[model samples]
Target: MAARIILNPTAGNGKAQKLFELIQAHLPNDVEVVRTTGPGHATELARQVADQEDLTVVSLGGDGTHHEVINGLMPEGKTIFAVLPAGTGNDFVRTLGYPKSPRAMLDVALYGAERRIDVGRVNDEYFLTVSGVGFDAEVAGWVNQHEKKGNGTWIFLRGILRHLVHFQAEQMTIHVDGAFRSEPTFLLAAGNSPYYAGGMKICPEADPGDGLFHVVWVKDLSRLGVLPLLTRVFRGTHVQHPQVKTFQTEQLTVEGPPNMLVHADGEIVGHLPVTMTVIPAAIRVRTGRS
Candidate 1:
């Protein structure tokens, strides 16, 4: 078997390209490296290679790249997937217990345990980490428009602070499994992994292989009240707060303000009125610990 590496040169502010060049000599000779040109290009490249039975398709970028690759390989689950973190906010790799060193990550990609993990689908899009609507989605929109400088955490913090000042909690109707709740929601996160928004631990108990999603919703909090909850998110203690609610389910639907944005794995997908479902053991991935 051989490896097909789909690299996004623009990810991590061009750091991905540099890392690949630095480690090119160390990679296996049978590997084929391909660089992505623009947004959604990784998906196209992945789709082109998904039918190969004796090949492993690896993504050498961040969460967005992984999300794209997963979407492209979906509905056809024959291709094996692997990831080497080379982008800012590599949240999906974090959930998989990936090492920080590029060499170690690459080693795992070449020889690691294969595990089947669940995938979350929002409308028709697939996400390996987390997806949400409202406040965090607004922050994602802000981060998308602004030029990022320095660390990803700092950039996201700046975006959150800037948007919080003018952000309004949207009225949303949420249905989980069969239960229903209609309220003013600040943020609704359905997570298949434990981390998002640069290691925030928004859904600390999420397990990608569990075949269920950890759903969290924040409601009835004033703007100032949200600050303390945001702090708890870093420690993953926000779920204990009174205004926050957490549950697990296989599916859910969210209806909110028409203009409210929705984000999947940190990339803005579309507006609200979205339905998310879980596909058990949807994709096979090479991980640090099978």
Candidate 2:
């Protein structure tokens, strides 16, 4: 089968270009390489290639680019997506146990086994990893708007601190599997994969193939309350905290104050009052041996 690689050279502080070159060096000599020129170009390229050619389509960029690529290839198509993880967070790639190095990642892309994984749906939108609303979405919005123009964990730190100072909790009513939670919350995340925000394992026990999605809700916290738990989240241990609640469901609906911020896989999608569900094994993923 033909293999097509869509490269976004601007990803990961422009290091995606170097990764693209390395991927080129290791790919089978017959594979075709296409460079994306600007935002959303990678998705367009991926969809076009998937529709017109019987080939494996690879996305070589960060989570946003990967997000776009998945949107381009959903709902029972023959095209298979493999990620090269050449972006800042590469969170979903990490979830699949792929190495960070370009050569190592390409080795899997070249030889990895194929597996079926779940993809999430909000209204009709697709999210391979997660969809978040409330406080974290505010953080994501701030990060995208004011992020330091460099590559490092500290940049995210600064962004979070900035958002924390001004972020406000919202009254939300969450309905999961017929259970209701009416509370003031800092954040609510529904995940198909286990992590978001770089590599923070927001739902540590999540399994994409389980035919269920996981949700994490952070209750209203004081600055003091949220701080100690922040480290726990990065360590994938925040679920142990009392103010944090985790649950699983096949479907959920969230209604919040009007004009609430919404994010899916780190990109702001729209305002709140959304319905989300898990579509069991809805997509075919190129994964390594289990």
Candidate 3:
């Protein structure tokens, strides 16, 4: 079979072109490279290829690029998904144990196994990672509104501090797996993958293909109490903290302030009072983790 590499040239500070060069050096002759110009272009390209070409589709940027390519390929079962990790905050690729180094990630794609994975949906949007409404989603809106430069955990750290100072908790009513919670919460995250925001393990127990989503909601924590828990999210021990509540469900409906921000996989997707549902094992993806 052939391979098609769909790249977003603007992803990861324009490092995708360099990654394409490296992949060209290491890839087989049958693989072809295609670059996307803007939002939704990758999905359209992948869909056209899926309709006409017999090829494996590889996502060659960050999670946003992967999400777009998946949107392209989701309607048909014609392609397998692979990751090249060339974008900022490659949380999904890391979840699959692929190294961010171009050569190593390429080797994993060329040699690793594939598995059926789950994808969640919020209204009409698709999310391969976590979806949220509340404090974190508000922060996502800020992240999209401003320009972020440089890398490392500090970028998200700065955003967190900025939001924490000015952000207020919302009163939400959540129905999950036949249980109900109505409270004032600072954050509510429903996770498919274990990681978010570069590498915060918000739901360490979450299994992407297990047919259920993990939800973690923090209710009424003081800023002082919130800081250390947020810090511990990287290690995934925040779930064990006193102020956090962890639950699992197949379908969840969250209603609150109609104007609260909503995010799926780190992008500001919609406003709150949204519904989320898990499509279990709905997509086939290339992975070595499972």
Ranking by TM-score: 1, 2, 3
lDDT of 3 by residue, 161-278 (tens): 8988878887999987677879998899999989877788987888888999999988888888878889899999999887789988888999999899899878887887888988
* TM-score of each candidate structure, all chains considered together: 0.97, 0.93, 0.93
Candidate 1, residue 230: lDDT: 95
- Local lDDT at 286 for model 2: 70
Alpha-carbon runs more than 4 Å astray in model 1? none
Q: After superposition, how far is residue 148 of candidate 1 from its true place, in Å?
A: 3.2
The alpha-carbon RMSD values of the candidates against the true structure, listed in the order shown, are 1.2, 1.9, 1.9
Instruction: List model 2 lDDT by residue over 35-110, tens digit each.
Output: 8887778767777766643477788888888888877777544577788886666778866777657787887775
Q: Candidate 2 — which residues are off by over 4 angstroms?
A: 51-54
lDDT on C-alpha atoms for all candidate structures: 0.87, 0.79, 0.80
